[model samples]
Target chain A: MISAVSAPDPDVYLMLRVRDGDEDCFGVLLDKHRNSLVHFLYRMVQDQPVSEELAQEVFLRIYRSRASYEPTARFTTWMFRIATHLALNWLRDQKNARSEERLDEQWEVADRKPSVEQRMVYQARLQEIRDAIASLPDKQRAAVLMHKYQEMEYSQIALVLESSESAVKSLLFRAYETLRARLAHMVTGGTR
Target chain B: MNCPLLSEQTSDVLLDYSAGRLDAARATTLQKHVLVCDACSAFLAGQAEVWAALDTWKAPPVSISFNRRLWQKLRFRIWKSAVPVAAAALIIMIGFVYDHKSQKSQMEIDQVERTLDDIQLLRQFDVARAL
Candidate 1:
């Protein structure tokens, strides 16, 4: 059994308990961060099961490395540091293997209604945005996802991607540019 | 009304204007340029749609057993750490028990040797005849 203070949140206090050998503290941590982490990784890999698998691996690493965990950074920064590394490596390997051409696949539009034209339009729009994001070179996708989805400031993203803040900004700018170009239809139709 | 000024504002409009990362002064910086620039206005409009649509992309739901699986993994890792310590302790306990038994055996051997030495000495003294 876990205490109330430590059971509900993934705060630094709970993490401190985890560091001190409270195995259950990790369950609390997983509960708190699991949704967000899964979301972030899902945007990257576009596969639920793979993201879930990798998420588990990430937490396992956190637990295994708890002995050396320091308070030098926020627990999330350390956690995302590991997560971003795995994602970037996976992207790199996918590049080498020249993956299954996700740029043209409209996988994100699954499981929703398609009868009405508006719903179809919405679905198409979602697919366009997803495909545009997927078509971005790996770094740009990472930048875009890290910025917009993960809500990381430039400095935090820099830490995850191991780049400088200015560089991260520039990457986001480029990513935004690509997204804007590909999504020009949506933008143009916005005020029309 | 200058073309260059409008063109300069076009690039920055997409970065800060659309992402909502800009403050008042920076947003004001683009105001004059966007007033006359049709292309930039169109681009920003598109950004709004894309951003909104992207927000609807809910992640696939995590499995119901995700936490359980994570806990299982966590348990395994915890046990992995404890295993070495347990093994080392077991080894130490076994070594201690073996050393203790060897010590006991050595004491028994000493006692047996004393008895044998006494018996040999009596034989050398011919104690059987009670001379």
Candidate 2:
């Protein structure tokens, strides 16, 4: 059971409604979280199709388990915990045979006309960044993605990763340290 | 202010500062320290660069059919689970019919046996009267 907080979370409320067979509430939850969840999975696995498939599975699992849904934590925390589990399991299964094809997949930004040189430069930088992220250990990769991209707080990330807050901090530190070493050439003295 | 890099536990202060998660007062303190502290300065600069580079890797927009496909899969799952139940119900109905037919056939056989017994008794009585 979720300990009572000062204010109830709206998503948790929606989930409770879903538990009571409110189909529309499920759709609301899906609309609210679909993009972020897909993006998170995309970053984790670096494959669009796989990410989308996994996100679908996540939502399906949630829907299937709605009968027993309990507001034990923040909705996103529970959602991301399931996502992180799937992403990690996928990475583990594909170890030593990771795909680089999706790394070269064109992003939406590439749709705008750009000079050939600029496009080349953009693709090169993107590849370097992706490779650096992909090079990290699976756990560290997950930690950095949640921390840097998702902007999840340490406690929330800890909950997702099933670790203590300090451990999460340590993971983020080490992961960032590795990224810093790998991408140090891109620094132009600009503020973050 | 003590440098955040001096200890493992406090190292995330630098990260928090870089990520803009530090409070205003602490951010100001870290900014001042970054000016004088080369290590923190370099760390912040590199982290910033990493963040900028990561920003370039935009996640592809989710497919337009994502929700549709998901709903389809869900419907399929419902069908998958329903198939077993439907089969069980059909089997139960078949069993009920088979049991009813067997009982009817047994009653018919009992009636035929009674008729044969009565015929044999009548034949034996006729023979006794002839004697």
B75-107 in candidate 1: lDDT tens per residue? 787798899999999999999999999999999
Candidate 1, residue B106: lDDT: 100
Candidate 1 chain A least-lDDT 10 residues: A1-10
Which DockQ value does candidate 1 get?
Answer: 0.29
Q: How many residue pairs collide in each prediction?
A: 2, 0
Q: What are the per-residue Cα lDDT tens digits for candidate 2 across A77-171?
A: 89999999999999999887766565344644566667677667767777788899999988889999998889988888888998888888788
TM-scores, all models, native as reference: 0.75, 0.86
Compute the DockQ of candidate 2.
0.57
User: Ten-residue segment with the worst summed lDDT in candidate 2 chain A?
Assistant: A183-192
